[model samples]
Target: MGAGIVGLATAWQLQRDGFDVTVIDAHRPGQGASFGNGAQLSYAYVQPLADPSIWAQLPKLLLSRESPFSLRLRLDPAQWAWGLRFLAACRAEVSARSTGTLLALAEESREVLQQLLADTQAHCDFTTSGKLVMYGSEASFAAARHQLDLQRALGGAEQHALSLADCLRVEPALAGSAARYVGGIHTPGECAADCARLCDALHGALQARGVRFVLGAPLGALRREGDRLVAVQAGNDWIEADGFVAALGTGVTAFARRLGVSLPVYPLKGYSLTLDAPVGSGLAPNVSVTDAQRKLVFARLGQRLRVAGLAELAGHDTRIETRRVEQLRRAAREVFPLACAGTETRPWAGLRPATPTGVPIVGRVGGAPANVLFNAGHGALGFTLAAGSARRLSRQLQGVAERPRTAAALIRSAARPAENSA
Candidate 1:
């Protein structure tokens, strides 16, 4: 029950599949986390969050004030449980397997997104600008090349491994940081789009198709009748549907718990800043740029630029930290001094719903009432994976036989309440 990108996309797909779908959200569509995202449709981003290398950097990361990822020590049982699972996922085999699965889904998503944009003609400030992942050190560049090897082994589109000179040739705007980068990787198939604009466009298109949207309707309770979810109570109004899909993002875990399902989703809070890109300034990057070392991403959307990164686990808190905001600002200025000339800056914070293994849980729940499904826990790649995840869930709802392993695992996990309750 959400109106963000995931929910909207799922509803759109379901409606197209001849289902009467209704969306309920506390706020207007695209007014939540979807409002200010990295705006990158990084189809080739297959790295899992719990990489084997993260273990080596964990200690320094926890101590360093400049680190992009942060953790808050808490006594909460959920936090401890999630942290242990995350550690277990740091194994080489586990991380590699998850990356392979995610890569497949990412490839499917790219195809689905292209068709959606072309068929629907949604104006979302969508751009076909490619993605450039810039590495700073010899070690990092080597790791990226190794990743390119993995991608090639997976047998998909070939991503070019660019030398520093080649990287500059592709996106000359990076001439400003010519001395800072060792090398870069370029994926021309990747793209960037304004996520909020897409959500708004989808909302409008869904409305035109007669799909119902219940905005400003805060969920109160779920109505269940003998192994089936009958309806949803949204502020004294009862909205009934034949089936229900939980795309609630950060709110999914708690909502699932009300139905006796234990979901291992937690929030990885992130921040973003939008600024105006002055025309004729050498500061604007034509293609999306990722600072691999600092874990920041910059994408051009129309006349504005979106910079997003930093992961903080603060337990569903939406408080904006000025220090983190300044850190992003400082990094932006260092990377593109002329880009920060604009006085107006729109800063935003969103809790990206993440799973321990970094793979999303998208399938029917075993413990939930019948006809209830999920399309959440996408973490930072929500926009990237939305279309494919929704398509899978829609196919399942239509009684499709084939299902992904992660989706099956989610259902199995839901059946065993004692599994992840630590």
Candidate 2:
């Protein structure tokens, strides 16, 4: 029950499949994370968060107050349990397997996005100019080669390792910043879109297709009959449906728990700042960019430039930390100082529903009240992989044909109890 990109995309795909779909959300459409993302359709980056070295890095990261990553140490036992699971998933073998699975889903989702954009004729400032991951440190650039190899191994033909000069050549706007970059990976076929605009277009399209939207309605609970979810109770009303699909991002975990299912999704809060593109600065990038070391992403969205990154494991709070915003501003200035227009900046925060293994949960929950499906837990790749994930979930919900077991397994992990008790 979300109106974010994942939920809306799932609903759109189902509607196209002739399913009577209704999207319910506690907030208005496109007013959540989907409204305020970095807007990069990053296909070259399919890496999982659970790196083998992440555990070692975490202690240091947590200790460093200015670090891009931070974890709030509350008294809640659930946070501790989630943290332990996150650490456990950081093993080399687990990370490798998760990376492989994510790459497959991301590639599939990319194709679906292409088809959807074409068929819907949706205009949302979409461009396939490509994406670049720039590195300041030689070591960071060297480490990225392994990731590039993985992408190539997974049929990412357009992915290439570019020299610093070559990166600037590909995106002339980065000419001045060439000295700061040692090298970068360029994914030529990757895309970028104004996410908010895309969501608006999709919302209109869904409305035209007779899909209903129940906005500003907080879901209370699932009205269940034995093993079946009969309807969703929201506030003072019950909306009954033949089937149910849950794509509620971070909120999915609680809802699923109430339904006696466990979803390993947790909130990873990220921040973004939007600024007007500097007039006559010639600093607007044609391709989206990721500063690997700083964990910041820069994307040019229409007349505005978006700088977003920094993951904080603070649960469900949208409070904007001034320090975090300053970090984003400083990073953007370092990359393209002239691009800063000195205009009033709009700051935003969103909770990315991150799973320890980095793969999203996208499948039907059997032995349910009805045809219950899930298409959530897509953390940072939500915008990049929404189309593909939604298409696959829609197919399963409609019972058209079964996907391969490997694909199904990647989408639907067996439910496990919270390792750290709340």
Candidate 3:
């Protein structure tokens, strides 16, 4: 039980499906990882973090001062277990398979998001301004082009390898740093928005739909009746429901473990900075931009610019590392110096509940109660894939007969709550 974007999204979907639902979270809605993110609906590029190229960059990732990815080499058992699985999933075949599955879910998510926005009539500064993945090296560009070819093979459209001239034509704001990048892969169907605003709107909509919210309510003991959830112990109060869904981000790991389930979800910390975009300034990005080498994403959110990146595998610490924050600041200044908005920028850091395969664990926990489900571990694409993941789970819980056959097959193993339990 949570009130993050994933939790709120799932509750909304369930409410729409005519289910009585209640959301419980220790913090206010969207105050966790959903609060600050890259702010891009990156649906087309579903590349997992465990790419084959990561093995090649292990040295730089471990030693470089300015490397966007880092591992602190923890002595924690969960970290080691997750790290081993992460290494194993770094093969080419695994990466390709994960990408395919993630893209399918992401595509569905984009559609579901659009439908939800239309149905709820909520405002979140949502915009479909397209996306540009700018590359700094020829090797990286070639690799990305190869990815484009794979997407094409998988029936993906509206994605193309853009020339330098074409990149400038699409997002003229990058002209100032034209010499910094080689080329870009453009996806005109991608979207961007403020995730916090979406969460706030979703919360309001759910309330209007008669859904109950118990904010600042930390989950304690979970009571079960013969492998079926009976009630949730929340700060001395027992809240009973027919079913329960855990969307508590990294907290899901411990909660699941209490029920004898092993979740591979680990926290990967990321940073973001939001600053006002100068009016009439040609320096602000019109389309969302991703710097290939730095692994940072820049999106224009209404009058503000959101720049986010860096993945730190350093446990669940949410402290904002000034060094990392400075790194983002310098990158913003270097790329769009004139649009900085000085020191008035809002800096934030959050732990993304990441998985080795990058495919989220949006299913039921084995050995847990029959009615308990999980919708956590979305890694970096939580907001991007939340709606579709929630919709699928809602249908599964509702025992819908018209569910997509293909999706059913894909999630059969995951849909079973007792898959590995006795």
Q: Judge candidate 1 against the unseen true structure and give its global Cα lDDT, from 0 to 1.
A: 0.82
Best by TM-score: 1
Ranking by TM-score: 1, 3, 2
> How large an RMSD does model 3 have?
3.8
List the candidates' TM-scores in order. 0.94, 0.92, 0.94
Q: Candidate 3's error at 420, in angstroms?
A: 16
- Clashing residue pairs in all predictions, respectively, total 0, 4, 0
Q: In model 3, where is the ten-residue run with the lowest total lDDT?
A: 413-422
Instruction: Sort the candidates on lDDT, descending order.
Output: 3, 1, 2
Against the reference, the lDDT scores of all candidates come to 0.82, 0.77, 0.83
List, residue by residue over 1-422, the lDDT tens digit for candidate 2: 68888888888888888889888989877777787788898766877777775766667788886677998888866677677777877776676666666666777778888878886788787888788999888877887887778667756647888999888888777876778889999888887888878888888888998998888789986777766778997767789987788889889878877776666678889999988887664577767888887788888777778889999998888899989988888888888877876574779999998877777777754433345677778888889878877887776766653432232243334222111000
lDDT of 1 by residue, 152-209 (tens): 7866465998999999888877888878899999998888999999998999999999
lDDT winner: 3
Shift in Å, residue 233, candidate 1: 0.2
In candidate 1, list every pair of residues with a backbone clash.
none
lDDT of 3 by residue, 10-34 (tens): 9988998899998898888999889
